[model samples]
Target: MRLSRRDALAALVAGGVGSLAGCGAPTARSSPSSREAAGDAAETPVGDHELATLVAVAEAVYPSEVEGVGEFVRTYTGSRVEGAGSYARGVAEAVGTLDDYAAEFHDIEYASLPASTRRETLEYMSVDDVAPDPDGTEAQRVRHYLVNELLYALYTSPTGASLAGLENPPGHPGGTRSYREGPDA
Candidate 1:
């Protein structure tokens, strides 16, 4: 289900998330796999609930418990060496918006909403593509940090190479270059 910016803003307003003073809401979301679950336990500066929100969003994007794509992204963001702090902060903020929306709308956290509803919420955000308020809203924040940026990081990184099934990813130290052969001759 797509929502135009106006519709999305109206929906968010109806949900009452727009009235929130700050992005401070508790949320419950599950890690995708044993590795991610383990990753989830490692602890980071980002709040546990906030991290869970990130993981939950990841699950929605990849939908694979074993792949742990989202968890991997989380790890990548943390270890990024330069901008990790900024990325983490942005995601934490977006998750706050999501949690607030969920709490006010369904009387449950966004992560706790039924899977279909969670997906719809994300779809709504993707389609709307605008913040509900002057300063900002969670939907736009989530799309920017979690959806677009996170996916870009995933698909463009060495980790994305694994997902794409490359024998030697773009910049490995000493791996064979297989793509030069081209499709079967």
Candidate 2:
């Protein structure tokens, strides 16, 4: 049987993936208004090229059944990178590495490549085989900054959580009734 997105998400949630929810909520500083209030208006949140590449990565990594991939990636990644210091730098470096690799081999930007080709390029980079590490090898960094980041964003979102049969994701408050009822109720 073909595993649908819900099936995969449900399996992950059943396997204690909820613990990964410790990735935490976006801070106030991540908001554009807050950044402007803090006098950081001059700094760009995330580069266009980098964001585009990230969107492409999300498309390749996220389950095809997930809708609004572009918007979700932009909102999630943009907030995560804004005023994020070292994390933002890491994301930029990772996207650059992926894009450069694509260009060298495919003669085009990673974001411009077809979806299947993008997946193939990631496999060629061996991102799946590498452990996610910000300071490790090229493949590791890509896994950390691109692949893992997107997964984290998706699984933590309300829509994604519901796919796994979670009515409320961590950090999001369930209603008062939720406390009175079981998870399945």
Candidate 3:
């Protein structure tokens, strides 16, 4: 039967709504269930939430008394484009994945947990197996995507170099040529 333009529009909208109502929950989930599970999730923009998550993870991994993740993350993640997207995106995704894993295992978010839980969780990642290259371990994954990157940034900075007893590390030149004393000093 023929209908007026307004009637046709109304009928179309009703049909669309009816079809949507019958649909159930999605059959397939794209996101990884844990850090161990690899699944496709749409890339989200990196922001403070992600950065805070990374800072927590980094501190847990390194357990530094004098250093924090802020300067290291800001410097390395600033200009470089690496991992997942930019350096910032890589840090965000790694931390997000870790949080996903924590929620799946403990029914709680990573940052919300106590410091002990975070440490145990990261250690647990080390032995989680994909076989072949040992790098597949969750620890390694965390290290590669989070810790090592942060460490590299930290150890190369003037402060970190001094801590490591190096005079003018590779990336950080310090002030003048003589700014750094020998290891004996």
Candidate 4:
């Protein structure tokens, strides 16, 4: 078949228009369900809604009390960067699972009980007086994540620096002055 010049140009325009239309749709990288988009925010094994709720609760409890808590968490969520560890998520999982710990002690969910009861439940759990159940995997996971090790690291981090008031140059004076000589020349 023979084609005219005007028809050829019209066909090329139609092809260009189709290509532009396809480009407007999202690519794999931009899809809502794409793994790239999910990253650490949605990578946890826990349910998405539950994880979000836990994150919110954690922010409330800690809330950049010192300064860098939120920034540190955001940085550490996935990379495991040397200084920025995933302590925030670990803490959230641990505290949110308080209900499981409560069940081990009082046979009830932590949130289901009165505030006083919840506090008491945590107190007992903290000291191991109630004996946490190793069989409950989630509860065990929570305890594992929220231990003294994590707390210690967080307290040492910049996020907790304000609480300790660790200044750049320590306020206390050195025992020996710069010009002080050996005690017994």
Highest lDDT: which candidate? 2
- The numbered model that scores best in TM-score is 2
| Per-residue lDDT over 115-171 for candidate 2, one digit per residue giving the tens place of the 0 to 100 score | 999988999999989988766778988898889888877776556666777655664
| Model 3: lowest-lDDT 10 consecutive positions | 20-29
Runs of candidate 1 with Cα error greater than 4 angstroms are: 1-45, 63-66, 80-85, 126-137, 158-176
Quantify all predictions' global Cα lDDT against the true fold. Answer: 0.49, 0.68, 0.49, 0.36
As for TM-score, the candidate ahead, 3 or 4, is 3
lDDT of 1 at 98: 76
Put down candidate 4 lDDT per residue, 29-135, tens digits, no spaces.
11222222354664442333333333332343343443443333332321221121233334334545664566777786544565446435544555333233222
Model 4 lDDT-worst window of ten: 23-32
Q: After superposition, how far is residue 65 of candidate 4 from its true place, in Å?
A: 5.9
User: TM-scores of all models?
Assistant: 0.54, 0.71, 0.58, 0.33
Model 4 stretches astray by more than 4 angstroms? 1-43, 47-97, 103-119, 127-143, 147-153, 167-185
Clashing pairs in 3: 125-139
Which portions of model 3 miss their true places by more than 4 Å? 1-44, 67-87, 127-139, 175-180, 183-185
Summarize candidate 1's per-residue lDDT along 80-156 as a digit string, tens digits. Answer: 31222334445555666677677777888776777668767777655245643212445655776556544544443
Please report, as a residue range, the 10-residue window in candidate 2 with the lowest summed lDDT.
26-35
Choose 1 or 3, whichever is better by TM-score.
Answer: 3
